[model samples]
Target: VGAALAAAPGADEAYGGFVYIMWGEKANCLSQVAHRNLETLLSAAPNARYRFFLYGPAQAAGYRIADGLSKVQFQRYAKRGYDVHMRLVNARWGPYAPATGVRDAWADQTNVGEDWPGEDRPGEAWWYAHRSRFPYEDKKHSKLKSVQPHPRDAFFNAVVHMYLTGGVHTDLTVAFSGLEKLTTGAEAQYAMYGDGCERRDAAYDDIITEFDGWDVSLPMALYFPDAGHPALKCVLDKYDQAVQNLSGLDAMERYCLTPQAPNGFPFYHEEEPHEGDYEAPPPAGMAQLRPGHGACARYLLETCKAQTELQDPAAPALKAMTVEWMGCDAGFHWDQWRFPYAASKPFRELAAPEGFDAAGVTGVWTGAALHGKRWEEPPEEHFISKEIYRAHPATRWDHPALKAGLLARQWQRENAIADVEDADRVFAEDPDFPKCAAALPACTSFFHDFSELKDMQYYREDAPKSPRNAAAARCSPTLIIPGAEKGASTFLYSLLAEHPQMISPLKGAGFKETGAYLAGFDRPGQLWDKTSHFPLIRENEPFLTGDATVINMVDKGAAKRVVRDNPNPKVIFSLRNPTDRLWSAYRFTFNVYYKTHLPDLSYANIVNDSVDGFGQCMQRQLSGAAAAAAGAAGEDAGDAEIE
Candidate 1:
């Protein structure tokens, strides 16, 4: 963690901009004393940097249940308008824990007032463990009951994600979870593992494993009795006997579970030592599981006048901090029960002033989640997803211009200047307006991270000496390698990106294929801000910059937008025989989707869809200079027609 911060440009200097956000799933924050020790260094180095993106939105993001603040408090927080960065989401289900949160499972942090979510912490993930092996008399595990991907709820999460962003994710994250593995006694810690317990054979006698997703570095720790023990193996075999699908999960659990203790008692769950500073172990009653009920609600309230001055000066900068009774996935988190649906309720139905009507929220996919439908091709179904660009040509903007778009709108709105020609005019013309001798250089970008830059203040003429916002007229990408899907675009780009000089999005393919030129126009600055997007490098030092948005290859207007935004853009297109490319892409695309969301979709359906114009998605743009003339003609035509 310290290494990452040290690598940030100028982080070692008198005015470092690195902001470390200490967070985890539950309220496992350090004690006031520990928090203060870290706070002292940050407080003393005021210019070095100071900030923390509070983990307050865990409930709001459907990642947890409501543990902090009441419905009123939550609604008020949403109304207060906190910033949310949306990006490519490839969500899968499973119960896993963040590393920092490991200690939280032993004890909790939020113990302020009477209103706090009690010891169980129904909204946090750690407290959800009780729901795994045991259920209350009334309710049971939802994911275990459904046994299917909650794509629809995910769509709502995605839509909420879009609503939070100005309609597009800053970048994309194609991370897939579901990576789980079983381990024997060879793993890292034994029973005496940091849980404040004395060295004991109990920890070493069990089989402990991990279930993690996305970042392999982070995984959920799952502890079980030693599977090799004969007595324990007998109970596991019982579960193995009851499970019907012998070859599937049944076999998996059969080999994995300990089922019970060696002494023939039911499986026992242990909490870490909870004594002061964890020097002592938890007492009998304190460590045992208890059942209880919880209720929480959220309503997206229109941000009143609380928006930051620099966000969208026109429309209130959208911010929602809230979720519903969406099923809680297995590995067990009582706190996460029905998180998706429960927390998302507020985003769908925004709160209103007293006596006024509330905004009835609609899923981004509308009834798509409830309805049996999947986007097969073109006219992209999701707004931020491709089709919205085809529906409206003027919606696009390159990254640099996208950043400027917000400032342009702000300038235009404040000046009341309706003239199109003056759209680029700077509005801070007053003699008393603050000014700097020279414009600061843009921070070309070091990695996908949030720097000290806050809001549009970094876009002014007298921007900081070393750019706070990267002054991003020229998005860091110095090269472009649009592709013909089946062609070796992946192979070609990978080889190029490996060079020390080349820099790409950490989310590689996700950021590359984003047809932003078609959606970036009029997009908010957050769309390009560190909060929304990530850079691939470390420190501002750069040798080459570029991206490989293969989709841009098919969307002719996309290439045009890129060139128009930065005339010197280095562009390359990987070519191959149409037949070979299509054939390869068809098989590859079918297999990928099948493994992902389309288990029910057959190879025949994939072939049929490809034949019926779905393949149009693979074409590498319309050729010729006419297409490259750019959006000028099309945008003008729309403007003329409108006038």
Candidate 2:
């Protein structure tokens, strides 16, 4: 402590001034040392003045001395023009000290009693004596006066009153809903006091305070009884009454009702008068309503007709059919303007009703836009050269006698050659065609030159008995494509559709049933029976066998049928990384499902609930089903089986 004091920036200065003495254990021992030190300094340096300040435990020193030696010393310092001050450290001393006549020495030096009246006294005396009364109390006439509202509380009440009368209903509701009961008596008086509307408002404020901690959803439901909750109905009734009363009365009377607006008044309304001689018509080109048009034309027409019937009892038939046709035309044009894919021709042709001029435009030429830019009329020029044409002997001038007869023949040969050359160029440029050609094996001899030529006659007689022929007969097989929601199942299904034999069922059929059945499979025979009526492909077996029939059942059409039968069947079980899956699950649960049932539940609540064990339960169910399926597959099966 001494080191800290010595290290203090201004502690070394000789100009003596008032010193504050902190109280407590340290102060009790330090005060004496401080006083003695000050005296020694005074003896050494006569010009330096000294003062004593006793606070906390040090203040108790003066009182502890029955003869009051410390008190006498303090007075002596004061007499010698050295300041002496003492202060009480205990916060609770105020109330008891006044009644006991045990004045705090610090209080006397600061004139706190004169400044704040009885505030410096103990809580028992100061607070109990001036506490607010519930009914009313007269300050001047009554011996025991009630406490007045604290300034902060009075200001808050005034603001609340302004908001209520000013027609800020939402603000009033929010303010009242948040207020909690005050713990201290002084705080309570300051929070609820005074006469007129402010006092009346206090009554309602107390009721709100009582219910502040209740669940908001319960009251919300009651306030909206159509929602079928009694509590909500009661709250709504009170709210409605408050609004209605406020709306019917004058501002001053409304204020008197509850220091807030009376019932039936809306929070805010249009300020301008509607009933005036200078009423203006709507602005030019503004329609009374949006015209029935665009993709929603049919829907809009029906809606308009229904609205007309509601507004006018004597309304004629709306002619919705005729208007709808016109609306369809408008929709056609609208779609063409926005998205030209609907039209047979390109969008550029539609946009340019007049002839298109590609040269005038800055971009590269397109076939649709080059109609007028490339030629004023058809060129009619032949693509073939005369020299090339003459090369054909049938049409050469040297064979003039047969020229007329061979002219057609010559033209056909030239055209055929051009077509072959064009085809060859296209094949070379195409990436996939070359790759396919390279993958297929080349045959050196035709069927007539085969080593089994001697058995050809028998083969022809028994062609139906061949395995290849039977497989080809079973080509029109059903396909089953099971998939999880938003997974690659759809994409795979689309790709598989290109195969003529594969047939997929329409979407919306349950795909998960296949997975569920597969998970329960105890043997291959069970799987075969489950898919028996469907189509499948057999390995190295004839199509007529039972195995082949079972394999055929798993084709595209059967998959579709399975999905149709089971809406929630598990098809493919796919999962993302844990963090990503959790995020997706959270979004699906809260944004999709929870919004429908519990809209007011916060994100924090959802996350906390998930972390508290619900999420683990869901994950376990999914994994458990997968594990069961794997166990049923057999001991030799790999952990990551796809089919």
Q: What is the C-alpha lDDT of each candidate?
A: 0.27, 0.25
Across 1-643, the per-residue lDDT of candidate 1 in tens digits comes to: 1111122121122433222222221121111122222222232222332222222222212222112111111111111121111111111111112222222321122221114333522112312322232221122222222111121112122222222211111000100011011111122111100122122222212212111011110111121211122212222223233232334322222222212212211111222222222121122211121111110000001111122223435532223211111122111122112122222322113222244211121011111111101101112333212211221111112133222332343342354212333333433453321122112122243222334434444322122321222223224455778777778877787687555444444222333443445544323342333211223221222234466767777775766655543456667789999878866876786666646766555666666766766456433233222344445466555445333
Candidate 2 lDDT, 1-643, residue by residue in tens = 1111111121223333222221111111112222322332222222222222221222332222111112222332332223344433222222122322245433333322222333322122322322221112123212222112221112222222211111010100001111111111111111110101111122233222222111110100000101112221222222233334435433222221122211111111111222323222232211211111211112222343455557664644332110001112322332232233343443123232144332221111111111111111112231111211111111011222222112222232333222122334445566564454333222111011224423333211122112222222221222333333333344554454333222221111221122312333223223222332222222211111011112223444544433333333323333346666556556655675456656555656766876878778867776776677678885334245422
Clashes of each: 35, 48
Misplaced by over 4 Å in model 1 are 1-475, 507-511, 520-531, 534-540, 589-643
Query: Residue 406 CA error for candidate 2 (Å)?
Result: 40
- Residue 641's lDDT within candidate 1 is 39
Q: What is the TM-score of each candidate against the true structure?
A: 0.28, 0.16
Question: Which prediction has the highest lDDT against the true structure?
Answer: 1
TM-score of predicted structure 1: 0.28
